[model samples]
Target: MTLALTRDELAEYLHEVFPQIRDDFAIDDLSPERITMRLLTAERHLRPGGTVSGPSMFALADVAVYAMVLARIGKKALAVTTNCSLDFMRKPEAGRDLIAECRLLKLGRVLAVADVLMFSEGGTDPVARASMTYSIPPA
Candidate 1:
């Protein structure tokens, strides 16, 4: 499918809808099948051991897929995650940003499915992987 929103537009829409997390993520790239996003990791994102927390990684995955869906379907803030399966493969590198590469698997009328791979910035191996299903709001 063709893009309905550009990278800048998606970022703006996200900031408008989710102001609380407006500064947490950045759009790295946007494409028909995939979207790349980065989470600017900070002290607040870390756990007791100085590693990035699981919830922080999960947020990256969720937002990456959410942005991908909006890129193809336009601004639909009501579209929400229906199910998510995440695997923490390895501990994320400390003091590094996290990158989430989200691939759209299916974009149906009511449901959208995507897979996300998250890695510490500049890392070769993934730190986490996620499969997510989103419930799209009717137009």
Candidate 2:
């Protein structure tokens, strides 16, 4: 499908719909099938060992997919996560932002599925992975 929203429009819509997380994520890139997002890691995003926290990584995965959906479908803030499977692998590198690369596996009328791979900024290996399914709002 063609894009319903451009990258800038998607970013604006995300900020309008989710002000609470607006500062935490940045849309680095966008395409028809994939989105690249960055988590602006801060002290609050780190664990005791200074690595990015699991919950923070999960948030990146969640928002990245959500953004991807909105980019394709336009402003559907009601779309919600119906299911998620997440795996934490290695510790994230210290003092760097976290990056999540997400691809939409399915974008049906009622549901959307996304696969995400997360890594510390500039790192080659993934630190976490997630698969998320979202329930799209009926038109």
Candidate 3:
């Protein structure tokens, strides 16, 4: 399948919608089936236990999937997360940045589904996983 938005396009859209987080993540890879997001790790993302915070992981996964959706459907900032289930499976590396691998499960006009696996940079195993559904505002 042809992709409507490329990595550069996603970055531009991200810059427009979320100026704060635009500096936090970068589009590492974009494909018809999936996307990879890299977090620019910082002190704020770490927890007291020397691990990445759960909220940070969740945000990474959420934005990663959200960006993947926008890549296919174009700018739709109103598209918001309706439901999400995240599993924190393991400890994350506090010193390294995070990576989110997002796969679009179902993309339609009103609703979309995507799953994300988050990994600590320089690691292969997923530290957390999330499944999210988005509600696309009516045009």
Candidate 4:
């Protein structure tokens, strides 16, 4: 299926609506059932044990899934996450950037579910995994 919004368009929407996270992430690519997000990692994103902070990972997962949904549905700012569950599988490399590859599992009238796998830049194993559900507001 064709996407309603392009990568650049979604990035602009994010910048305008979610200014606080403007620097936190950027869209790497967007496709029919896939999306890639890059985490603008910095010292602030690092935890005490030389790994990315949990909140940082969570943010990446949330934004990545949101991007996936918006790509399919266009500028749906009212679509809010209704559920989120994340598991940190391993410690992410401290210096490298993090990437989230998202896949939408189900898209319904009111809710959309997506699963995200987070990798540490060039790493082969996923450092974290997340499942997110968004509540799409009435039209």
Candidate 5:
């Protein structure tokens, strides 16, 4: 499938539709099958041990897949996650932003599945991995 939205357009749409989290995520790159997103880590994203929190990483994964789905499906604000499985492999560095690379595993008429790999900025090893399923609203 072709991409329905460019990176700039997607960013604008996200800001207009989801203002609460618009500032938290940045689209690094986008394609028909994959999207790379960055979580602009702040102090509020850190946990008690001064490491990036699980919730923060989960948010990154969720948004990454959401962006991927939107990239192909256009501005479908109602597309909602139906299932999510996440694995935390290592602790994320508090000083570095988190990057989530999401690949669309399946995109059907009513369902979309994506796998996300998350890493700390400038790090080679992945910090977390996620699989998410989104239910698309009927056209």
Candidate 6:
């Protein structure tokens, strides 16, 4: 399906609907096939060892999929995660932003599934991987 929201429109919608996390993420790229998201890592997102925390990575993964679903299905802020499986693979680099690449595995009338790979900025290897399923609200 064609994208229902452009990158800017999606970003704006997210800011409007989720004001609490408005400053935490940026949409780096967007398309029907995949979306690239950046977590603007700060002290609040890092753990004691100066690496991006598990929770922060989870947020990135969750948001990336949510953004992808909204981009395809229009501004449905009520869509919520029903299942998430995340794997922390390696240490994220210090002083670097975390990036998540998301691809929708399936997008149906009531549900969507996505896979996400997260990496530190400028890194080739993924620091984490995630699979998530979201429940879509009825129109």
Task: Tell me the whole-model lDDT of each prediction, alpha carbons only.
Answer: 0.95, 0.94, 0.90, 0.92, 0.94, 0.96
Superposition error at 68 for model 5 (Å): 0.5
* Model 4 per-residue lDDT at 83: 95
TM-score of 2: 0.98
Ranking by lDDT: 6, 1, 5, 2, 4, 3
Q: Which stretches of candidate 6 lie over 4 Å from their true place?
A: none
- Per residue, candidate 2 scores C-alpha lDDT tens digits across 1-139 of 6889999999999999889988899999999999999999999999898988888998999999999999999998999999999999999999999999999999999999999999999999999999999999999
Which candidate, 1 or 4, has the higher lDDT? 1
Per-residue alpha-carbon lDDT of candidate 3 for residues 24-131, written as tens digits (9 for 90 to 100): 898899999999998888888888978888888889998998898888888889889999999999998778989999999999889999999989888999999999
Residue 133 in model 6: shift from native, Å? 0.3
Sliding window of 10 residues with minimal summed lDDT for model 1: 16-25
* TM-score of each model, paired residue for residue: 0.98, 0.98, 0.96, 0.97, 0.98, 0.98
Residue-wise lDDT of candidate 4 within 1-139, one digit each (tens)?
7798888888999898899998889888889899999999999999898889999999999999888888888888889999999999999988999999999999888999999999999999999999999998888
What lDDT, from 0 to 1, does candidate 4 have?
0.92
Ten-residue stretch with the least lDDT total in model 4: 1-10
* Highest-lDDT candidate: 6
- Which window of 10 residues has the lowest lDDT sum in candidate 6? 46-55
- Backbone clash count for every predicted candidate, in the order shown: 0, 0, 0, 0, 0, 0
lDDT of 2 at 76: 88
Which lDDT tens digits does candidate 6 get at residues 92-115? 999999999999999999999999
Clash total of candidate 6: 0
For candidate 1, the clash count comes to 0
True lDDT of residue 102, candidate 3? 97
Where does model 2 exceed 4 Å of error?
none
